[model samples]
Target: MGSATAQALVASSSALNAAQGITLDVAGELFSVGRLIGESTALSGALADPAAPAEARTSLVSRVFAGASAPVQDVLRAAVAERWSSAADLVDGVEELAVRATAIAAPDADIEGELFSVSRLVAGNADLELALGSRLGDGEGKAALVQRLVGASLNPATTLIVTSLVRQPRERRVRRLLNRAMRIVSAQRDRIVATVHTAAPLSAEQRSRLGAVLTGRYGRQIALNEVIDASVVGGLRVQVADDVIDGSIAARLADLRQKLAG
Candidate 1:
């Protein structure tokens, strides 16, 4: 979140956006490098250490990611050329770039929806979430589990994002990782994600009107991912980024109870 990390991410994002052909391969390679750095404290530290010479860092990238594709090596070189806020931030930046590259490769894919579905799936299954997010478990095992569960049904971008997250969670929960990935995918499409929770599913007309209203309010097209939550009672709860518009009766009752008690 520091200036250096932000600047590095922006530069890397532009590079990914400008490149064409072999993007999917680039994404895979970046994900692999990110995972490697994320799991290795020493390697990450060596790359992000400001005291070290830039050439040394670049050389380290060349040595470590030497087998990666030329495009991937180029990305790593660009990434290491800049200073990072922390070792962790370096890993995060690489992972974010990987996700962005994947999104760019599959411009027409509904990656946000697929990510949301995976988040909900993990949230609903505590054992599965624990298994995948367990720090004690093998990263490859978790990745294999994701592959087996998703099979070929998911979009390639979705699969890559999920696999990368499962492998290098970096102390994040599965749900948080998926939400972040969803936001990244949404930004790639020049849209924002709105999670709408309602007692029942909205009709097509209702969905259209809701989307229109949200777009007007947010000044951007909204992608609605509807969730049927009976706890919402008679109304809806919508979340856009960090903002929550809770019109649900459940929220109202809770607010009223707190006010009356006070």
Candidate 2:
């Protein structure tokens, strides 16, 4: 997943940095590039496009995000500039790097969350999400659409992230990478997340009750991500690793049917 990839990059960079004594503050620029890539399918496709030469692609990224931190540009060149082969792969690489850098820049903060969340606000809508993340359009169209929607004067860090991903693609889903990064970071500090699915949106009180129940049952603090799935039919399904607590009406129906058949 994206988080694992980001962590791998982080590990690689950590070793590389330690060996070469190259330290960087890449958060601002990394964010810039990550944002740009997320906003532009064309940019993502272009970066990963095999037709373009690596040097040319790297130069394009640098030119587009000229205002980003110099260190970030260096990191881009080192991590993805020459290694990317497809659009998806490049996006993944750039995104992973940005996620990692963002985490390091604000170790105890929610910078990555803020970045991804706000982006979801803009690109989260179904139409835009499909346009940006889908395979319906070619690379150029994706870039143009992104620029049209985001405008040219975005923050440098955001721009860098977006543009780099546009040019260099990743193989994994962007959200997955980000989530994994957040999870790994949180786990290191003893924070774990559990996703809760419901037949419909849960009330605040319900979420609170679920959280308390899950905490008591699991014996560990948990963060709940609520999702609505009408098919679940009036019950909850808490999924944490191999565990599943199905309180769904659907399950009850199946049980009843089985009993009748017996």
Candidate 3:
């Protein structure tokens, strides 16, 4: 949620626009870097520090990503050099560039990962989600937080995906932004984003059955994202895009108890 994060993502998008013929693996690696930077306050703070020697920060980036592609390295250096409003802003610029490159690198794989990550962001926290998705905060603030989150992950594709989100209208909430993003990604690649939350991971058989049920009901092919949520207790919560099918035992018991009390 720092300003540098936003600038990083925006810078990332610009980098991706300049990138050509990047590979899927490269895109994934870049996204990982962006996410790492975004999520870790220490790392972002170090990089965003004006007093910190540019050489030192750049050197750190190089050492960390020595084995990465030349393009990715360039993107990282460029992002750090850019004068982001805050550490969070740094993340935004870098991530934007990364995702665009990833979309070009591996359309199918990148779209899935982007949707999954964005949705996960929505599911992560309430205050952050609201702040990023609210009109009360300016684009600069939103961009910063998004950048940090995506920057740590460092996928060119992830960056590109996040950049688009950062550019949307201010009225959208984080969850809505994620949903809209999932739809765009799905449409681009002819896939569906089905977010499934459960007490534990679904078995292969369960996934298959659930996939079939969702596909039949929605009339679209889906890529299932299984999110393990221990708080759900004994039941499963299946979210096929916007539609939530929660059949958790805890919910049922609570419902029954409430009715009895009533």
- Best-matching candidate per TM-score: 1
Residue-level lDDT tens digits of model 2 in 1-262:
3554455455535532333212224654564576577668887777656577878777877887788666776776565444454555555555555545544444445433343443554445777655566655565565566566653554433433443344323344545543555464445334556667787888989888887888888787776766677878888887775678888899889999999999
| lDDT computed for candidate 1 | 0.88
122: Cα error in model 3, Å: 5.4
Task: Indicate whether candidate 1 or candidate 2 has the larger lDDT.
Answer: 1
How far is 37's C-alpha from truth in model 2 (Å)? 14
Ranking by TM-score: 1, 2, 3
Please provide, for model 3 over 15-114, each residue's C-alpha lDDT reduced to its tens digit, 9 standing for 90 to 100: 6557655776666666667777776889888877888777888887898778888878877877776556687667654544544555567655556656
Distance from true position, residue 224, model 2, in Å? 1.3
lDDT of each: 0.88, 0.58, 0.68
Scored against the true structure, residue 173 in model 3 reaches a CA lDDT of 59
TM-score of 1: 0.89
TM-score of each model, in listed order:
0.89, 0.50, 0.48
Candidate 2's error at 201, in angstroms?
3.5
Residue 242, candidate 1: alpha-carbon lDDT: 86
Superior by TM-score: candidate 2 or candidate 3? 2
> Candidate 2: deviation at residue 32, Å?
6.8
> Judged by lDDT, which candidate is best?
1
